[model samples]
Target: MSSSFFGDLRVVLRGARFRRLFGTRLVSQFSDGVYQAGLAGFVFFNPEQHTSAGAVAAAFAVLLLPFSVVAPFAGVLIDRWPRRQVLLFSSLVKAVLGVVTAVLVAQGAGPAFFVAALLVLSVNRFFLSGLSAGLPYVVPRDQLMMANAVTPTCGTAASSLGTGVGLAIGMIGGEDALGTGIILFVAALGFAAAALVSLSLRYRELGPHLEEEPEEVRAAVRNVLRGMLSGLRHIGDRVPARDGLLTMGVHRVLFGVATLMTLLLYNNTFTGGGVAGLAGFSVSAALLAIGFFAGAVATPWATARMSASTWIASLLATAAVALVVFGLPFSPVLFPIAGFVLGFVSQAVKVTVDTLVQRHVDDAFRGRVFSVYDVLFNATFVLGAALAAVFVPPSGVSAAVVVAMVLVYAALAVGWTVRARRLSATCKGRGALWA
Candidate 1:
């Protein structure tokens, strides 16, 4: 079974288009991981030069804000433009920004450089959103779950490896200036590689433009505005898609809350122990990455054993349990264990939800549907982080807020799943529009 699973993964990897995209993503994700580490280190070590941690966090918030706000339009663009060209343009812009950031930082331009870096990061995120929105066009619907699982698994692996290497380089470089240069150089290389690979891809038209007619444009605008309403209406109108989105939404919210909690704990609570704290945090992250990889490897078997909805619900419940476990004042050993479990379950949910969305949504509107989902997920996370920052002081309050948020989210998810199941049954009996 393992051999067969790997064989299937190999086939996906070997596909010409997937290979190019995957190859680009592999390098880009690695650099992204390294850049993240370097960014944190840069802030921590040189807070006076750049900005406060709070400011940095706000920048991250800004970077992600566009995904929720502009994603519908971005999705439309993805569907309208040649995906390869979109990717190429995005990557080239990112590379240029990276070089500009490196130059500004090296010149000791202070907070301005940091602001510029944040802007560039925001741009890079937009491109990533586009790539994610366009993914359905590259792979067949049937294989989407596996593809989703594999891409993130690969990305997590790269993150783990890249983080460790970046840390080592940062330590060796011995100064913020030197470290920033090295890190930015790597980011530039990654973006360059992504641009080159994107250029190599053979462009193919997926379908009709999302807004070919003025009436269609107006309708698309209305549809996007009514997306949440449309989603709710569709839930009443279509059972499978409704159930899938509900399950996926619950999973995303839980994962987001739990992740925020863990990161806050690591950054704040575990600070005093110095190298020990750092080592513990790194180990916890590595374990989480491994968990994601394991979950992806097992996705095919898990799918074979249960329906996607069942898999999704089970994963959400498992993640809820993990969050509770993490929140408890337990031994340090339990922290990593909880983190690993959360990571594994979250990866399972991601794969299942992505698969369900791809299968259930109309092919023409797949990008928009996924974009809507992405917007919800991103918005919730930003809200969670903002609330945590606002309500939770720099001390114990932050941790407490994070824990409480996770528990609340978990309860909501449980309720949602129950309601979704009941709705599914009722739709079946009434011969309603759900299924």
Candidate 2:
């Protein structure tokens, strides 16, 4: 039976273009995990910089801001360019930026260098959002949940490894120049490898195969903004699309706030040293990874057992409760387990929701819809990070902020579920394509 299960998994993994994409995405995500942990460690260890929770929150905000602001244009660009080329170019750009940052840091550059590096990293994130927008084109609609599960599982696992490695390296460096430079160098190498994998992808053009003249292409460019505006207008007129966007927005806001709180609590309450901090970080990451991995592994089972809407509502409620518990005073040992539960439920809801969106939206405008969703997702996270920075101090106010955020999210989840249920009832007799 175990062999049969493994054989079935292999078949699923090998049956689509998305598998190759997933493989490359795993490498890139691993690099991203390492870079993020290393960067956080760098900022925390430096005496002059603000080693506070707020600074870490700010870094996250900076990283996420572009996804909101730049994703629409990225969507248009992806539709215009070959998807493979876009991914390759984005990876190359990131690799160059990584190398440059490493070189500057190794030369004993100041805060300006780090800031510049972060800015470049943020742009890289914009490209990543574009890549995500393009993913629907690379795979069948039915496989979306699987793709989502696979990507995040790899990411969380990579994060766990990167965090452990970064902590160990930080300990060895002992404020030495070589230690810091070595971590940065490793990150640069990861980016380079991601670029190479990106280059290996096969290109397939998506969207209208128009054979327009140069002048017509310019005209099309002029109309791109108008087209985007029209798409938004179209979404507004469509109830399912509108409802889906609202649902996604609420979920993303909660996720962003919770994640910010987690980072703040981890950094503030647990200081790096011999065993405690290292163990806590490792356990927390492990729990998160396990949760996501479980969600991914059980997605088909969950879908079979429950309606999509039911699964979403139940999971969101569970996550909210978990966050509330996370905010309450608990043993450090309990934190990782709590985090794991939250991560699992949140990802399950996300997978259900994403599947819904893919089902509801038409192929013609799917990329734009996904891009808009990405923008909302990023914007909410930026807002959450900013709010966390303002309200949650390094030491005292974090728990209160986390509790308040959880309550707010819980309220949103309740409202969303009610609205969804009513909408479902209203459309019950109608033969909707999504249903």
Candidate 3:
């Protein structure tokens, strides 16, 4: 490990309040894992359910698309309301929805189940946004980067842990609606636990304190569109922010394609039926989680030897080539390896993009920029999934789709090279590019 990595870890651990805040994030994200894993098990693995590429894409859309549509509104609410309250109430609501969803799943209620699941997933936008908004309050500004490094990475670990537990539950329960229902019941309890953690924080501890008494409810709704516009304009004005976000968006699209391909391969090709398919998918997911952790640990060390921009481009290029290398044979055994590589490379790019945006964008517009970021992230992901449904087959072995991913990733890498060279020249003249 590099000195910066250890030093950052030491500084973050020394803060009591940050630890508590981190705990809250850990609990919430863990519950998120349980909830999502249960849903995937129910929708994709149940013997009673039919699986296809389009069906998988629809499921992915149900999980994320509506939330993307409402993200701007959720961002407004995150800024307007007290964030501590937002986390507390949103989590509680998710708990109730979880219980309802479990009942729907058990009863074999189809559309109703999706409707309930959508609500359960949608509330998370507020909870996660509040957590991101509240980070600055828990730690000193100098420690912010380190805080970001530890908090999300740990939260992701907790989430992956929850998924592992859910998988165990699924294995014991078997591949029925009843088993899935039981898993979701446990997920509900997890959300309730997260809500309890939220209670430990002071009321105003996570905040977007209104400087003056603000707008009426009707007016605020009207301004949501305007706020989104202002955020776009803000990104447009900053070259580094725009470029970094573009890189992140491109990665999300490619990641989405990879995700759907993996899901279909495991659910329909590798096992093709029963509880074993879920187990296969779970193994793939676990490998991806390990890769995510590896990426976080390795990114700081890698950046010490190169600029973040160069590293970002290099990672993308590597992913592009590796996709072709690992995916050409299209073996089920190779998919797990591909999953790990994609997870590591994509996460490294994400961390770099996040740091770049934070450094370049001003505090006043940070929330808005992130809201825009969230929208682009989810939208591109949904778009990719939808496209994959059109391109990938039920077997998840489509040479056409593989070729498309390689081309897109390679093109993004070339674009990154051009942007990095321009930014390098700009930095030489100006002292810093991000600033």
Candidate 4:
């Protein structure tokens, strides 16, 4: 494998299938950013909506809990259906739902508006799961790490760019119900464009390589639980991937708490909840993009030289120290830097875990594994937010919450380091197995 990130990219992007899949991810996630930003403005910055820790938790639950509900079905179905078609059709559904969501947003922020938004995001879960499951089909098995790094980082960058554009639309249109609706409608067009791009792929372009006959709907529904358990068991047997996932779950919960805290800080204490708060939010978003890009660039090169476990342990430890050093102050200058650090940590860990899962899991269960991964990602985050809502203030300044995140990061770092040592001891080719 190449030590240089660009070298890995040059080798991997040479595949036409990879490029098509990568393009689909970029366009779809970019639209996701726009949709998320549109909703964020309405829920967090709009004077009309209430901004509180409890409210933030409620909004996250409304948007994310449904993603958990759909994961089992999505996993089982993705394994049965063609992944290429999954991306194409899911995008189409999202486009239609986005329009409906825009119409609802114009009626004012309510349960109906959130329901519409969540529907768009729920459909998005399918599109995203397909991207992860389909990646191994596109790239060389040897360079999966670089592929993971580049695709998600670039998708996130595209999403961040879309966020700025959406916010600009909201601002131009007055940042009200009508403005937010316009932003969402424009975002819907992006989804349509994504669907158009996905048309380039052949029917079996991205595959589960299914050898068995398709199961009946009732049978599949009954099998969802069985399938997920199978996935979990499969993961448990792949020690490295299972450990990576456990590490990821820990990061998500801490990250989730920090996320709500940031929302509250921006909405209330940091800027007093208006365009000023939005600007601060935008700055953090931009910094996050930079951090993600840096992490992406760094991971491929760094992991080329070190074990994946070592890199992850280091990053988690860095997160613990960075949070206390930069976040304790909670000054505008320091907090954004903290956001950047966490962003980098997030991408690096995720890129590692994504590669581990894809590398270890069989194609037959890949979709199901990624979908269960979907549940692990969102469900844990929501769990964290719900737990934090009990204590985090509207001002978003909770020394105790920050302390909790720091301690968790530290503990996870130690645990991962010890596991890396164990993997090294038990495996003949430790680097090859873990990395």
Candidate 5:
């Protein structure tokens, strides 16, 4: 909202290194959006498909839960490899996988279709961690927070725009196998574009320097066994970073359930299970996109005025209140408003946590910690969808789920307030830590 905030964006984008890196992220995430939109259309929005809560839960678990298990390995390698190379090869792999996935979708949105898509999505997580891990190298520490604020938000906005593109493609493709396949093929092209963009960054330009690389293959194996623990220890007892992880992981669990309910409600209950359902859900997605950008715009100014803990606590509490206010009656018109509010809150919290980790964790362990971050993020979301399967009805109207999320948000907010006050009372670095 302020001229100075716009000034900061200009400042961060001014560098060639940052520009190349930023361009890579934007292009890759746009592909992510396009890919996801195609999947959603084939799996959920297709009239021939009969979607259930159990099916949704199983789909997410199959796609994400395995990825969560193997993610640490990717993290360890990311720390060992040149990040730019990781970006390049991962993009190349994902592009090929994207084509494979498109072919499977054309056959039918079958078991293999999900599995192929999972491979692409898993590589996406690895690529994203490398981006985050390498970010500190491109921007000054002083500007890292602003960089986090800008990059993820813009990336998400690109994803949202890509979703719009996917939707338009889906229209031409007509929500069938052939249509979804065409959309996915377009997404694959986007990945190829990302690979080309990544070439602009020199090898090892974003990295764990040569001295830090493991000496041998056996050492790499040993590193994998111990590296996760090292990353966890590195984050230990630093209240802001640790609690930030906990809050975000929990938030995703609750939000994931909410997302399931929204999808089911729009498709089965609100819009009557056709193209209309997807069109309605797109409204929520669009609102969320706007909210993400709003959060990025608001965070720097908000954090500058108050401690990160206070700001994050206020956001969690606001989500609780917003869920109650807008989700109570489960009105079709109101859920999108709730989506916008929670989207803003979610992105703001993420930006804060990213800054917390970037500022607090050592560079050597950043990839691992962020790997841990991704595991928690994805795992909890699956847990939420699983919980939804058990509790939320197919109709997606569940007062119980609404009540549960509010309580969790309220509890997390209280915990944040108490714990932060205690930590600030004793921490020597509290001034820097909380800021």
Candidate 6:
């Protein structure tokens, strides 16, 4: 680990309030990992379910589409309401939903499962937005980037650990109603714990200034679409924020494609098809999680040395190259390496962009803006998965698909490089992106 990484941790973790906030996110994310793993096991890995490219894409859409639809409005709530309450209530709701979902999954209720799962994840979007919006309140501006670096990345790690536990349960207990239900119930318990942690903070601590009276806030909530539009206009005015969101958007699309491709390859093309393929996929996922951690560690240091714009462009270019080198052949040997590289580069770019947004965007509009960001973050991934469903075959050995992805990445890299070059030359300052 980099010294800067440790140094950043020391600074942020010293705050009791920040620690409580971090604890809420950590426990919640661990639950996320377990819930997601259980869902995947039930939906994709189970012997009963017939897995296909379209089915996977549909699952992705079901899992994420509502977030894209609902988060913008939820962002309005994050800005308008007390975020501490939002976090607390959201956690409780998630816990209840988890129990409901477990019941649905146990009963093999397909349509009901989708509905319950959608509700669970949609609230999850709100909870996450509140956390992002609330961070600036707890951590000082100077440490904001560091907080961003540690929280989400560590949350990812926690989630990954949860996933491992969930997978272990599945492997040991069998992927049936009883076992999956148990995992989800455990996840619900974790969410309840997160809710308890949220109570440690004062309700007003995570604030939107609350300068306006209750009537104005109510009106703002009513006009969610307008609020969302206003947030976009805010991003439009800020060059760095605009660019950062754009870059992350494109990256997410590629990530979605890469994810689906990896799934297909492991499920169908690998030496072990069913249980073996899942094991291999899990190993790849573990490596990818490590890569995510590595990126989080390295990004702060790398951006310290260069403009974040430059770093973003560089990472994009690196991903472009990685796609060709590791993706072209699509070998079993190369798959894990490719997954690690992609995970690292993708997360590095995300951490950088997240810092840019949190730093550049003001706290007043942060929730709304992040909601927009969340939409792009998830929607693009779904779009890419949908495209992969259309293009990639069942075996996932498509040279054409790989080549197409490479071109997209390369084009984005060149474009981002050109844009970042201009920013580096013109916008030299002590602001967020310059650090």
In order, candidate lDDTs are: 0.62, 0.62, 0.77, 0.85, 0.87, 0.84
lDDT of 3 by residue, 1-435 (tens): 243655666778787777777788888888888888788877777676658889888888887888888787677666666788988998899999999998998888689999899888778876777787777777886556566666777788899998888777877886678878888989999889889988888898866655542444324334777766666777899877788888788788878888888888877788766577878888888888888877766777676556677777788888888888888778888878888888888777776677777666654456667767888888889888888889888888898888888888888888877777876776763234233
Which residue pairs in candidate 6 collide?
A: none
Q: Pick the candidate with the highest lDDT.
A: 5
Quote the positional error of residue 434 for candidate 1 in Å: 12
Cα lDDT tens digits for candidate 4, 219-319: 43357777777777889998778988888988998888988888888888888777888888889878978988888888987776667887898999999
Q: What ranges in model 3 sit over 4 Å off?
A: 1-7, 212-222, 428-435
Candidate 5 lDDT over residue span 89-200, tens digit each: 9999999999999888888656788788889989999999999999999998888878999999989989998999998998887757899899999999999999999999
Better of 2 and 3 by TM-score: 3
Model 6 lDDT tens row, 96-171: 9999998887787679888888898988888998999999899887787788888998999999999999888776
Q: What lDDT score goes with residue 169 in model 3?
A: 82
Candidate 1 lDDT tens digits, 157-225? 886777887778767765557666677667777778778877666665333344554554435435545
Candidate 6 has an lDDT of 0.84
Clash list (residue pairs), candidate 3: none
lDDT of 1: 0.62
Candidate 2: global Cα-lDDT? 0.62
Per-candidate RMSD, Å: 4.6, 4.2, 2.9, 2.4, 2.4, 2.2
Instruction: Look at candidate 2 and tell me the lDDT of residue 405.
Output: 58
Which portions of model 5 miss their true places by more than 4 Å?
Answer: 1-5, 210-222, 423-435
* TM-score of every candidate: 0.81, 0.83, 0.92, 0.95, 0.95, 0.95
- Candidates 1 and 4, the one with greater TM-score: 4
